[model samples]
Target: MSNYSTTTLVMTRVFNVSREKVFDAWLNPKMMKKWLFTLEGTNKVAQNDPQVGGTWEIVDHRDGKDYRAIGEYLEIDPPKKLVLTFKMPQFSDTVDTITVQLKELEQGCEMTFTQDIIVPHEETWTEADIEKALGEYHDGSEHGWNLMFMGLKELVETGQISYKG
Candidate 1:
């Protein structure tokens, strides 16, 4: 038996738009910055190469700090599914995997997003430290995703960006 556990965040949201539009939002630089990282910051970089084995990098400057994330596309199926490796060096060295699946609906599309993260166990980590780390990670991820999805729904449905910062 292994003494390791995985930290996973699963989220689902339905958008009133075509599957293609919803899918493109994940790759399109303009659409991504509008919804994905609309915080009070300047998007210094939004380079996306949406192809198998292709990599992407985004850097956002906020409040004298830089938040950057880099990833590579593992799988890409148009308007349906995408799998990628995500890493934020500012946070941790561990690389996480994200899987996004889009299903066509009667009115629009439904998106199922999942992020699988491996939280390594360290000899110096106590139980409380582990719990705290896990809780923070989950909360941060959930909050960010929820806000991003809200922006996405608004953008795709109304052709407007709600959160401008």
Candidate 2:
């Protein structure tokens, strides 16, 4: 049996907007800042050459510390799908690809995001730490994604960016 494990997080949101507009929001920095990592009143995101092999970074400042993450794009298909690598500084070198898809419904547009991660060595985590970390990550995943979706909705509906959380 394999000793590796993978974690998959899927989130879906319905926005009252077009797929193209939704897609552009992610690709655009002005739109991204309105939601991306805006929690706790501190965050930053920057993307360079946001295509395949393109670079991206987000610097989060909080509690008198700076946590930085950098990555690159693996695939890009406008108004449909996007795949990108994600990496955090000082952590193990793990490549994560975020797959985002856009679908149109009578009510609005449906945006689905799936993040898949392969943890090479689960033993590196103690049982207690593993449990705590997993719980925290799961909770953050839900909260963070919801925030992003709400931001998107606000922008599309009001022609202005707003964050309720």
Candidate 3:
């Protein structure tokens, strides 16, 4: 019985590309700018130092607002596995952990993304508020990641970035 609530989000997508190419997209600044930020914003800043203990940050600007995400690499196994800390300071104060695993298939590579979010308790938050907030966060995260993955697949396969919106 942990005091904090944990929400885990998992998504898997197969890219029609080699494992190395698929893995490189997550770390390469140029590739990340092209596919990683698919929400309403455009990526304004993308910086990545892909190594154990290295940090990365991206800023997306849209509608006169800036959305920033920062993280540090925890574990990096080239073209195979990556574990990192993900934080969106504008949204939440809690830091989340994201683990990405890549497996090479006969045709392409399959990537699995898992995010574990720790929901903190606030004195002013009622049960209903907490539930609603968590639900929205979960849904938004799923949708956003799915869209980004679609863009990633397109970029890695056809060398084009296509966003649904």
Return the top candidate by TM-score. Answer: 1
Give, for candidate 1, the lowest lDDT window spanning 10 residues: 33-42
lDDT of candidate 1 over 36-72, digit per residue (tens): 6654246778888999999988888888888898999
Model 2 C-alpha lDDT per residue in residues 1-165, reported as the tens digit of each score:
255445677898888878888888777766655555553256655445778887877676777877676778888899898888766756656666678999988967899988775454466677666566656655666676777677777876676764433
Model 3 per-residue lDDT tens digits across residues 61-156: 877888899999999999899999999899877888999999999999999999987787667888887887677777888988987888888888
Task: Give the TM-score (vs. native) of candidate 3.
Answer: 0.88
* lDDT (Cα atoms) of all candidates against the true structure: 0.84, 0.71, 0.84
Clashes of each: 0, 0, 0
RMSD to the hidden true structure, all candidates: 2.6, 3.6, 2.7
- lDDT, model 3: 0.84
Model 3 lowest lDDT segment of ten: 34-43
Model 2, TM vs. native: 0.77
Q: State which candidate, 1 or 2, has the greater lDDT.
A: 1
